[model samples]
Target chain A: MTSLVIAGKTFHSRLFLGTGKFSSNQLMQQAIETSGTEMVTVAMKRVDLHTPEDNMLEYINKETIQLLPNTSGARNAREAVFAAQMMQEIFETNWLKLEIHPDPRYLLPDPVETLKATEELVKLGFVVLPYISADPVLCKLLEEVGAATVMPLGAPIGSNKGLRTKDLLEIIIEQSNIPVVVDAGIGAPSHAAEAMEIGADAVLINTAIAVAGDPNVMAQAFKMAVESGRMAYEAQLATPHREADASSPLTAFLD
Target chain B: MNLKLEILNHNNMNIIINNNSREVAEGCTLERLIDEIGYKEFKFAVAVNNQVVKKTAWDETILYDGDKVIVIKAVSGG
Candidate 1:
C-alpha cells in the first residue's frame, strides 16, 4: 500500500480516525491503536477546560498521534476562524480541520463560506483542511486557495450511509492535486476499502468504529481493508468489460 | 435624614456563571472565583458577556453583578 503524504508529513496508514462517539476514552484509545492510523481528529468545545487530564486527550495525546483539531460548532467563516485561532492558542498546533455548517440538523457544509474560510485560514499560516461536500469544482477552488488537504464527506455526518456520493467523490479524486481524505458517513470496512480502491488518499471513519459493538476489531478490520484496497489500486486493477464474450464464440471477430 | 447602608460583603452577589444563576462574594476576581470554584490549574477558556478572556488576563478580569461568565473546556465531539 502506498503511504499517504500530506503537507510534507508521511502517514503509513490511509485510514484516519475521528475521536468521537466512543463508549469510553479507553476504548477509543484502544481502537486508535488497533487502527494504526497516524492522523486523528479532535473537536474543540466548551467543556471542563481546567481539568488538565481530559479523558480523551489523556488517551490520544502522543508523539505518534497527530491531532487535527476541528472547528465543528462554528456556524460561519468568522466563527470557524475564531475557533481555529483558539485551537492554535490552546493546542499550539496550526493544523485545523475547518467545518462551517450553519444548519444544525443535517450539519451540511456551506460551500461559499467554506471556500472563503479556507482561503483566509491558509493566509493565516495554518495547515487548513476544510471539510466540504463532494463538489468537484469546490475542491478545485480550495486547491487554488492553498488547502493542505480537502476532506469531502462521503455522505452526511455520522449517518453511516457509506459512499452515497461515490460519483462526485470519484470526480474529486480525479481532479484534486492535494490529498482527498473522504471524511464522513463511512459505514463499514468495505466502504473504506471502496474509497481506497477508487484512489482516495485516505478515509476518515468515526461513527462506524466508535459506535461499533467491538471498536477494536472494527478498527482492525478497516485497517486491513484500507491496506488491501490501496494495494489493489497500486497493482493496477483491470477494468471489467461491460459485455462478456460467448464461450463457444458465436461470432468470431477474427473471421 | 434617612440613609441606605450598602452592605457589600454581608450579602451574596447574584451573577450568571456558565448560564446558571449563582451567588458569589462581591469583588471576586475571575482568578479568585475560579480558584474558589476549585478550577485552579485546570485548562479552560473563559468569556465574559461574550468577550473571551485569555488565561493571562483572568487575574485582572473581575466578575461584576449580573455579569454573564462562560467557562468552557474540551469535550467529546467530532
Candidate 2:
C-alpha cells in the first residue's frame, strides 16, 4: 500500500483516528496504537493547556501522534478564525481542521463561511483543512484559495452512515489536486477500507471505534481492514462481473 | 435630531452591512468600531455588516447608521 503523505509527512497508516467520546484516555490511546495512526484529531476545547494534570494529552504525547486541532464549536468564519488562532497558540501548530456548522441540529457545514474562512486562514499561514460538503466546486474553490487539504463528510458527523457521498467522493478523488481525507460518519472498518480502495488519502474515525463494544479490538479490526483494503487497491482487483456465461453462440457465424 | 442626522450620514456610505441594529456613528471606520466591540481577539470576517470586508480594507472602510454588519465565524462538522 502506498503511504499517505501530507505536507511532507509520510503516513503508512491511512486510518486517522479522533480523540473524542472514548470510554477513557487509556482506551483511546490503546485504540490509536492499534489503529497505527500517526495523526489524531483533538477538539480545541478539550485541550487544557493550563491544567498540569491534563489527562488527554498524556496518552497522546507518549505515542508521538501529531495533534490536529479542530474548530468544532465555531459558528462562522469569525468564530472559526478565533478558535484557529487560539488553538495555534496553545498547540503551537498551524495545522487545523476548519469546521463551520452553525446549526446545532444537523451540523451541516455552511459552505459560504467555509470558503470565506479558507481564504482568510490561508493568508494567516494556517495549513487549513476544511470540513465541507461533498460539493466538488467548493473543494476546487478551497484549493484555489490555498487550503492544505479538503475534508469532505460522507455523512453528518458522528452519524456512522459510511460513504453516503460515494459518487461525489469519487469525482472529488478524481479531480482534486490536494489530498482528500474522508472525515466523519464512517461506521466500520469496512467503511474505512472502502474509502481507501477509492483512493482517499486517509480516513478519520471516532465514534465507530469509541462506541464499539471493545474499542481496542475494534481499533485492531480497523487497522487490518485499512491495510487489507489498501493492499487490494494496490493489487488492483479484477473487474466485477454479473454472472458466468456459457460458450457464446451469438458469434457462431465467425467460428 | 443629531441621532437622525448621524443615521442619515451613515446611510450614505457605499459599504454593505448585515446587522443594522449596531447603531454605529456615520463616520466610524470599521477598525475603530471593531476595536470598540472588543472583538479583535475573535477570528471573524466583517461584511460591513453584508458585503465581506477584506482584512486589508478593514482600516479604510467606514460604517454608517442602519448598515447591516455581519460578523461571521468559521464552523463545520457535526
Candidate 3:
C-alpha cells in the first residue's frame, strides 16, 4: 500500500529496474514482468545505420510502466542537458535519470557536473533523478535545485559490493526531504531488503538481476525482498541491544 | 553520360548520418531522410549538429552537404 510518488506521479512498486545487461530483450521483459516494477530506467544511444535493431520500446508497455530515460554516457553538464532534450523527444517523457560519469575506470559520478545538470534540467521542466555519491550535502543541494529524487550509489556502478556507503547513505536518507533511491552496487536481495529496512524510498537494481543464474527467479526474489523490507519498516523493527535481554521474567516461586 | 552524371550530382548531396556518409536528394527534409535511412519504423529523436529537432519540425528541416545528423533511440541501461 505504500506507493512512491514523484513529480505527482504514483509508482506502486518501489523496486525500480534497469533495462540492461540481459542476454536478450525477451529476458529483460520477463524479468520486468516478474519483478512487478512500475518504473524502469533506459539509456539513449545513436542508432546504428548499418544494423538497425528491433525497437525495444515495443516490449515495454507504456500504459503499465513508466520510462525513465538516463543520460548515462554524458561526461559533463552540457552533454547531459543535450541528452535530456533528445530523450524528451525520443521517449516523450520528462522523467530523466541524470548521470554524468566522466571516468570510465570507476564510473563514479562527477558531483559538480551532476548538480549543474540537475539545476539546468529541472529548469527545462524535466524531473531529474540524479545519481550521486553518498554525500549528504550534495543530496541537499540537489534537492534545493529541484531534483525529484536523489539516487546515491551504494557502491560503484556494476560493482555488486552492496551498500559500501551505508553510513553516508543513512545520513542522506535521514536528512533528505525528497525520496532517496539507493542506486548501484546492490548485489543481492538481502541488500535490497536492507536498503528498504533502512527507510530508502526505493532501490534501483540491474546487474544483480540480469547476470543472475536465473534472472526470472532472481527478479521474483527481489520483488519479495522489497515488499518484505518495506513491510518490516512499516511494522517498526525492535531496537537492537548488545547485552542479553530476557524475554520471560524469572519467578521467585519457580526458584 | 557526362551530362547525366552532372545532373545527378546537382540533384543530390552527401551528408553524414550517424557518422556514415550518404547521398540524399538535395534539400531533403529530415522526415524523408529518416525514411530513407530505415528509421521511420523506429521511435527516435534527431539532432543536427547537436541541436535537437522536434518531431513536428522534421518535415520542414532540410539537410545539406556535410551536415551532421544524429538520431538517438532508447536503449537499455541503469
Candidate 4:
C-alpha cells in the first residue's frame, strides 16, 4: 500500500489508533501492534503528566509509536492555545490535534472555536490538525487557515456510528488540498475500509478496539481492513450503478 | 484587615480575586483550596507552577505564595 505522509512524516499505516479506555496497558499495546499503526493519539491533562510513571506513556514509548497529543479538554480558543503551548513544551513536538468543544454532552466540535484555534496554532509554528464536523465549508475554512489536516468526525465520538456523514465526507475529500482524515465514531474494520475506499487519507479509531473482547485480534483486523481498503481505493473502484441494466439492451432499436 | 489588604496590594503576583478570596490562606494545599471552592462537581485537572499535578498527589502537594494555579476541565470537546 502507498504510505501516508503528514507534516513531513511518512506513515506506513493509515489506521491511527487512540490510547484510551483499554482494559489494560498490555491490551492497548497489543492492539497497537495488531493494528500496525504508526501513529497513536494521547490526551494532554495535568493529572496524567503528574504521574511521571504513567504506564500509557511508557507503553507507547516502548513501542516507538509516534505520539499525537490532543487538546481534548480545552473549551475555547484561549484555553486550547494554552494547552497546545504546554503540550509542545511537555512533548517536545510542534504537532497537535486541536479539539475545541464548548458543550460537554454531545462532544461535538465547535466550528468557530476550532477555526480560531487552527489559525493561531499554525502561526505559532505548530503542525495543526483541527477536529471538526463534516461541514464542507468549515473544512475549507480550516484548510485556508493553514491546517496540516482536517479530521472531521464520522459520528459522535465513541458512538461507533459508521460514516453517517458520508456525503459531506465525500465533499471534503474532493475539495481538500491537504489530507482528510476521518477521525471519530468509526466502529468496525469495515468502517475504516469504507472511509479509505472513499479516499480518506486516514482514520483514527478508539472505542472499538479498546472495548473489544479480544482487542489485539480486533486491532489486527482493523490493520488488514485499512490496508485492503487503501489498496482498493488506489486500484480505483468501478463506478457504482443505481439500477440494474437490461442484459441484452432494452433500447435495441438502434442496434 | 487593612494591613493584610495593603500587603496583598504590594505583592506583585497578587491580584484582586472576587470569589472566595478569604478562603485562600497564606499557604494551603491545592486539594484544600479546590474543596473550599466547591469545584468537585466539574471534572477538572490542575496544573501548579507550570507542572501537572495528579489527583492522587493533590492533597500532598502544597501551594506556595506567588504560585500560578490553573484548573481546567477534563473532557472538553463538544
Best by lDDT: 3
Query: Which of 1 and 3 is the better model by TM-score?
Result: 3
Classified by CAPRI criteria, candidate 3 counts as high
The local distance difference test score of each candidate is 0.84, 0.77, 0.93, 0.79
Candidates sorted by TM-score, best first: 3, 1, 4, 2
lDDT of 3 by residue, A122-204 (tens): 99999999999999999999999999999999999999999999999999999999999999999999999999999999999
TM-score per candidate: 0.86, 0.71, 0.97, 0.76
In the range B27-57, model 2's lDDT, one tens digit per residue, is 8888876676553334444565335576678
Candidates 1 and 2 compared: the better one by TM-score is 1
DockQ each:
0.37, 0.03, 0.85, 0.07
Which rank order by DockQ, best down to worst?
3, 1, 4, 2
Chain A fold similarity by TM-score, each prediction: 0.93, 0.90, 0.98, 0.92
At residue A85, candidate 4 shows an lDDT of 68
Off by over 4 Å in 3: A252-254
Fraction of native Cα-Cα interface contacts (under 8 Å, chains A and B) also present in model 3: 0.91
Task: Highest TM-score: give the candidate number.
Answer: 3
Model 1 chain A: which ten-residue window has the lowest total lDDT? A46-55
Native A-B contact fraction in model 2: 0.00
lDDT of 3 at A85: 94
The CAPRI category of model 2 is: incorrect
Q: Could you give the DockQ of candidate 1? A: 0.37
Model 4 residue A50 distance off true place after TM-score fit, in angstroms: 10
Count: clashes, candidate 2: 33
What is candidate 1's local distance difference test score?
0.84
Regions of model 4 farther than 4 Å from truth: A48-53, A245-255, B1-66, B70-78
